[model samples]
Target: MTTTGLLGAALLAGLNVLPVQAAAAPSLPRDGGPAAEVLARQEVLDRLADEITRVPEHERSLVAGYAGHTVDPRHGHLDLYWHGRLPDHVTKVLAAAPTGVTAAVHEASYTLRELRAGRDRLVGAVVRGEAGAVWTSAGPLVDGSALAVGYTPDGGGRHGVATAGEVSARAAAVAGVPVTAVTAAASTAASTRHSDASPWSAGAELTTPGNGWCTSGFGGWRGTTAVLLTASHCGTSGTYRTGAGAVVGTATDSDTGLDTTVIDVNGTPSGKYFDGGWDNGSGYAKRVVGAGRNNVGDLVCASGAMSGIHCSLRITATDVAAEVNGQWRTDLDTATRTDDSTVAVAKGDSGGPVVASVNGGADMQARGIISAGTGNPVVCGSVAAPTTCWDSLRFVPIAPIVSKFGLSLA
Candidate 1:
């Protein structure tokens, strides 16, 4: 387990496939905007994520998982999750590493590959109809180092109780797969209660003719065609609209394979994300510096319609998988708020921009899109110091989407 009590699960999933430079530490603000420590923390994580990706595939695979130090955010090293001894050479490389980032290996029960395969078998059983009327969704939990199979008991009855127990037994039968039960509940999607922008920008909502709302992931251009990035599940047919209800563009190139799409809009996107909603014009004008992967312990933030702007989410797992509308989406990424009090994500937050803030929150790097998150929140404790029950939120990383679509961030 990490110092933050995070679960160590799968590979970087599909996100760590690329190598990129970490953002340089932003200079301290002249007006005391953001703390120097805050800027340093972001830079360290950016460097860490970059260094992790720089490791060769063979060597990197030796790591089952990794997380940042919660107590010391600038510790400049990650706690590696692994089952047994790492090769001497791997240890040496990590120790003598020059990237300003390092890893400390921990003994884990299952390897990343084993855990990933474990969840695959469970999902396969569901698809094959071998585990009927049982699991609603089954996938690997990188942090917990096990497979989570979700089920919703039909009320409180002997038959319902028996079915849940039987499913657990069947899950254990899957060879080489550690099993765990997750309560599955259908969550109501959050909505865009308000928005404001004279012109459309990234993180705005895309409204469908039929009254559907999904967030615009980022603002940019595709060879002079004004375009906006969003979740592919948002549908290829929709009109881009500001929160104030002004039409801006049309949707196209919706690819569920990538879980991303583009919106061909009329005017140029401001190239800014609505960090504080467009109406207030509170945001950072982030440049599409380059594509990067999210690593455990990375301090990240997102802009959604319902949640607006919230941060303090730390990446917990990668190479995650989820079944959306009966179709399994693999190689996704997952994150959870470090402070349980902070909001991780909500429904309709989909397609919102996931960014890493730098330059004292003046700029950012696009990370991914909000895809899915835990459901059935149960409040615990007083409002002043309340705790929420939530697992993790999954995202479709930006690198793969840009690679597949041949688009550039605005």
Candidate 2:
């Protein structure tokens, strides 16, 4: 696939297209025909994206089930993907694609929608304890045709047959989907980030009005009002207080179905995002210039009271679904170690800042916040002093949260 095709797939899979300034075409002469051509193509691509959003939910699902699409900005053509030869009806739909946007179809495996559905089924099974001893999450391959189920062996050195088998069966039941089991370690459960918290600042520890502990996300403002963002699971309403025992805000709105909320704070929340959380003596201060969208392969670092700043974690997947508080949550992004190292996201890190480094870490763009993980404890240290750790971390992208609440980052 061409670069444009790759970008199209990334957007389809819930990734943000890089800003125009980040694209390589900028190196080309602006007055040259190539530059003008690229800009025009970008405009058309933007229209196509808007059209996609306008598609009704029912029709959108059918389109997803039928195939995926990518636009070759250079050629101004849209390429559709499918497991086999493009079906007749799908081809017709492509032929009628938005004017100025040419269309073609390429054969692939299962559609992205199918893969997401399969993942949901498998996760739901585990949440209901139908998956037994397997407590990790699963996802679809890049082509969106197959599922990868993750698990760790039980204390008996065995991944129970019934549990693993059930997960596979559920995924396989999804038409044209296959399951691949992976022996991955599980992460630890959510825990408070710090025993000592600071004034209401991004990445500082705070207790939900209900007394549930969590880290605050990036602060925002609406004219004279100050707003605080945090994980929805933290609590919907109550007086949120700083670790220093000062009341900072009131939880006014929360969407428990999703992992985000907004608090009405009395004072202006700081625009500074803790680079290395208070725990990391190496951490410094960085101002959040703007909010950023996430994509697979992006290098992101997160800050929390427990873990401070852990960087070099590569985002592996978007559109992740997991069971949270007896409900299945979807549209989550995941980060994993790019190399074998001790860096991991842990409890009390929830609702903390996840940012993409810029200028080699001197500045940063706020990305998202820690939500949940595999819930499997990563054991480190010698046999005599085993220490529990976190494996992988999942976060809800901040773009959606900001859009949902109609707020701007401070």
Looking at model 2, residue 56 earns an lDDT score of 25
lDDT of 1 by residue, 1-410 (tens): 53221222222121123222344555321112234455455565455545544532112344544311221234554555545544455444444444444444555666666766676776676667663435655655544366766676751221245355666676768736666766665322232524535345566655654576667777676878877877767666767676567776788777775577788877776766766532334443345444566665666776676455656666765665566655666666666666555466655667888877655455777888877665446342211112233435667788777766777767
lDDT of 1 at 254: 76
| Per-residue accuracy of model 2 over 1-410 as CA lDDT, tens digit each | 32223224433333223333322332221111123344344345434533543342122325644434444544555454565444455444443454445544455567767777777777666656652435365666544447776665461243454356664655466423788766554433344333323334577777776675678888887556788888877777788876656777888887765588788887786687665434533324577778655544455677765555666566676666655544556667778754344445656667888886433344567888788755345652211112234657888777667766888888
lDDT of each: 0.57, 0.59
> Each candidate's TM vs. the true structure?
0.73, 0.66
Model 2, runs deviating above 4 Å = 1-107, 121-136, 151-166, 174-176, 183-189, 192-200, 210-212, 222-224, 280-283, 339-341, 379-388
Predicted structure with the largest lDDT when compared to the true one = 2
User: Which candidate leads the pack in TM-score?
Assistant: 1
Clashes of 2: 9
RMSD of each: 7.7, 9.1
